[model samples]
Target: MKNFNIRSLMIFILFFSLKISAQNSYINQYKTIATELSQEFGIPTVVILSIAYMETGGGTSSACKVLNNHFGMTGRNNVNSSRFKNFTDSKASYRAFCEWVSKRKFYEKLKGSQDHNDWFVAIASSGYSTKPVEWKQKLNLVMKKIGL
Candidate 1:
């Protein structure tokens, strides 16, 4: 039993290490794009990264895999279906998200702010997600986990 417990603990550590590594890779892959979008859209870098991470499940979601939509945006663009919008590339998806956010009423009000909480509140209140409270909570958790 002691040996089994030791093996299980090692396995758990290995699994979590891999998970963290993958997550770090995902963040690094998108961080530059997110930063560029943040500069262009006046949104915080942390906000863009956290939302993308949460929506895409660290770039493993079906929408991201098949549609190249990291933001879970719904509409018809590249694809015929009026579901998730398909982009020519992942960068396009990120650009589209920035554009959408730039058009929001609160954009000018909170532009270039580094406060993640403010961005979360504005986004949630703007009906970005159906569950505003829960969405903000999840964003907070993701930001914390990612050490942002």
Candidate 2:
């Protein structure tokens, strides 16, 4: 009985620590996503990650889980996504978001090009925000706390 109790407590503590670590991992994951976006779109990973964290709470969010949505994107896509089965993961959701973003007319400006500043200007000038005024500021606040 004593051995079993001690082992159970150790397992509980180990599980708790792992959970906290995964929570912290989001900042790094968000940073990675930001870096990838900047390299491809001329937007800094900080800014992009900030936006994603605001939009999806670093992708551990209920919105992403319930809706498979990463960026709060909504529309009628021409991508022939009529089949709605086998959506088993967030990677699929993020891929869909990327495809949708890629298909935008303004995104075409990025084709065969490499200009970071210009890409950011395009993102801002394109009026992509339906809730812009507060999202970025809120993301910045969270980013500061995470040491990003």
Candidate 3:
């Protein structure tokens, strides 16, 4: 029993550490770009980062790796013949995301809102995705986890 407990504790610690690392890794990697875009485009930094984190699973998703599509965006795509735009890099993906936001009816509202949830709600209200309600919920959860 004692030996089993020790192994269990060790495994738990390892798993907890990896989870924390993945969480921080995503923020550390994209926080700069997200902040820059937020300042330039008026979108909330937290909203941008949370969306990327949720959509890409901290940049570990297969779509992110193979298609450079961190936002699950689908349009003008030529990368894999799946009708989704395959970006050349993470920066390109991020830029396209910003463009999509800028063109939405909610863009101005999002730009003016300081609340992360408001930003997310605006995105959903604008029909950003097919399942806006579920999408907003996920965004809210990610925003909460990220503390923004």
TM-score for each model: 0.93, 0.51, 0.91
Candidate 3: C-alpha RMSD after superposition: 1.6
Q: Write the per-residue lDDT of candidate 2 for residues 44-143, one digit (tens) a residue.
A: 5555555556567666765555655566666543343532222345555555545555666767667445443444455545565644445445655766
| lDDT of each candidate versus the true structure | 0.90, 0.57, 0.83
Candidate 1 segments whose C-alpha is farther than 4 A from its true place: 77-82
Model 3 CA deviation exceeding 4 Å by range: none
lDDT of 3 by residue, 53-128 (tens): 9988888888888898889887776656675668988888988898888998777755756687777777878777
| Winning model by TM-score | 1
**Whole-model lDDT for model 3 versus the true structure?**
0.83
Local distance difference test, candidate 1: 0.90
Q: Note the residue pairs that clash in candidate 3.
A: none
> What is the TM-score of candidate 1?
0.93
Stretches of candidate 2 off by over 4 Å are 1-23, 76-126
Please provide, for model 1 over 61-148, each residue's C-alpha lDDT reduced to its tens digit, 9 standing for 90 to 100. 9889889999999988665564888899999999998888888999898997888898899988997999999999999999889877
Candidate 3 lowest-lDDT run of ten:
76-85
